[model samples]
Target: MYQLPFTTVVESATSNTKKLELVVHPSVSSKFKRYLDIVGSLVGLLVLAILFIPIAIAIKIDSPGPIFFTQQRYGLQGRPFRIRKFRSMVTDAERLKSLVSNEANGLIFKNKNDFRVTKIGRFLRSTSLDELPQFWNVLVGEMSLVGTRPPTADEVMHYNQRHWQRLNVKPGLTGEWQVNGRSRVKDFEQIVDLDLQYQKKWYPLYDILLIAKTFYVIFGRIGAC
Candidate 1:
């Protein structure tokens, strides 16, 4: 695995040694970036709060499940944490996952017309309103305002050393994979490349730019599905 910081900043796994070695990266301890995350998340939470009532009503009316969906996702250095989203699918979506064929290649999964998605869920997903609750994750420091998208445990389980490099930075609410083309990019390897690219170019300014770019991407609906 490449890295991400929380309890520890980063750890590198050498294929030859098969041992985890600690490697500190600048983004891990940048107080400036942390400050950005705090401020950004608070703002995001406020926005979510403002929109919660209506969104909740729509979700309840459209589906018979909880308003929010929380799933175990791997964070920086592959740590497990619950990533929250507005429920975008039927209650039994997880159980029925095997019935839906994955259109994406490699460790990740995706289906454009996933039958499980509720009508309101599609709107939430395309507009990214479904991800609002994750600001809490960013506020609490489990994620960043801008970083790689968090992956599920099963997806991480299948990661190779090259793919592990993406986790070197904390998962973000939006990032390279996100702004470039969310689920539109089907190949998992391309996603790894984007994540690594973010790691390479990361800085507080760059993070700010990505955060700014996210708004454009979302509103324009460039790559929601």
Candidate 2:
């Protein structure tokens, strides 16, 4: 029997320690990349300040909760961090998710239309405006401008060995999955595959390309939300 770092018992008796260990690579510890996140996030925060006011106002008028939404998410090395986003859904959205979720494709729940999403939430999600506040997370070193998508604690709990590999580096607001076609790919396993692909190939040039493609995705409004 093999003991695991996360728990006393493994998820499967046949699970291979070598395969699980392979998920975390040594190159994940990149000091220069962390520095880049700080500088880039600060610059992004400065630019987003202009739109913050109007977006905040819209959210205030549309809902009664706090202006920002904060939740626990896994960061570099599977550490927990409070990731912030603009409030796009109603305060009770999480509580109502089970009822509103359309179906589960493996670990993720998807719904083209969810009832708990406020009017402002709909627009924010569609434009990816809800994610603006994550720049602060990036600045503080909890995330990156471009990397694997962060999974919530609940999501992480559901992750198998391959999916946990995403946490080898800082999570990002945009990544290969976001620019590739976010809404079109609803399968949870496929999302995990993309994250693994990112972990194996992170570099400054790749980050730059991801950022450029992200801009195009944002402007082109293709498969967002």
Candidate 3:
């Protein structure tokens, strides 16, 4: 793992007189984890390729916007990245955000009944198929198979110390929040706790377990979106 030069506050100023800039989670340097991400992302991309045509056609037929939605999101250590997903809402959804009521609390935002969702988008989210394009993010090494949920740029702006700690690991396609309650767990603080808990419980095998659980959660329709 490449360590950053001194850049943070006095909390990082140890006796060595060097400041620490970010959370240095052990998974960042795990060769095995990278190997798994490589193999899994390749396999996921293969699946995405097989399903892309149908999904794209469905989106085009059902909505006026582009097939994919791209947004700026905060990734590991507060870095910015363009996260992609199948477009599940109107193109002007961001502009209309204020009109929609946010049901979740804290820094995150959510509205289960958000009106911006199109008919086909509802199906995609319900089946979790809307997330397929993120396999590309994993292939490019911007994310992991199991890690914290990626936050929007706006969400990161409100983060304090504890919230920022969740950004230590790469974002994931499915994780603790995805499996635990996703929509059911509406509070951002609780999501932060879950992210930190995953860190404390992390290991290579633990990631595999989360992956398996992800399948169960998907099929069981435990937590959509």
Off by over 4 Å in 2: 1-27
Give candidate 2's TM-score. Answer: 0.85
lDDT of 2 by residue, 131-157 (tens): 888899888767788877777666766
Number of the candidate with higher TM-score, 1 or 2: 1
Candidate lDDT scores, in order, read 0.83, 0.74, 0.83
**Which 10 residues in a row give candidate 2 its minimum summed lDDT?**
1-10
| lDDT (Cα, tens digit) per residue for candidate 1, span 119-201 | 99999999999999999999999998888889886776566667666777888888998888877999999999998888877
TM-score of each: 0.90, 0.85, 0.90
> Between the candidate structures 1 and 2, which one is better when assessed by lDDT?
1
Task: Evaluate model 1: give its TM-score.
Answer: 0.90
* Candidate 3 residue pairs in backbone clash: none
lDDT of 3 at 111: 91
Query: What is the lDDT for 190 in model 1?
Result: 93
**Angstrom error at residue 53, model 1:** 0.9
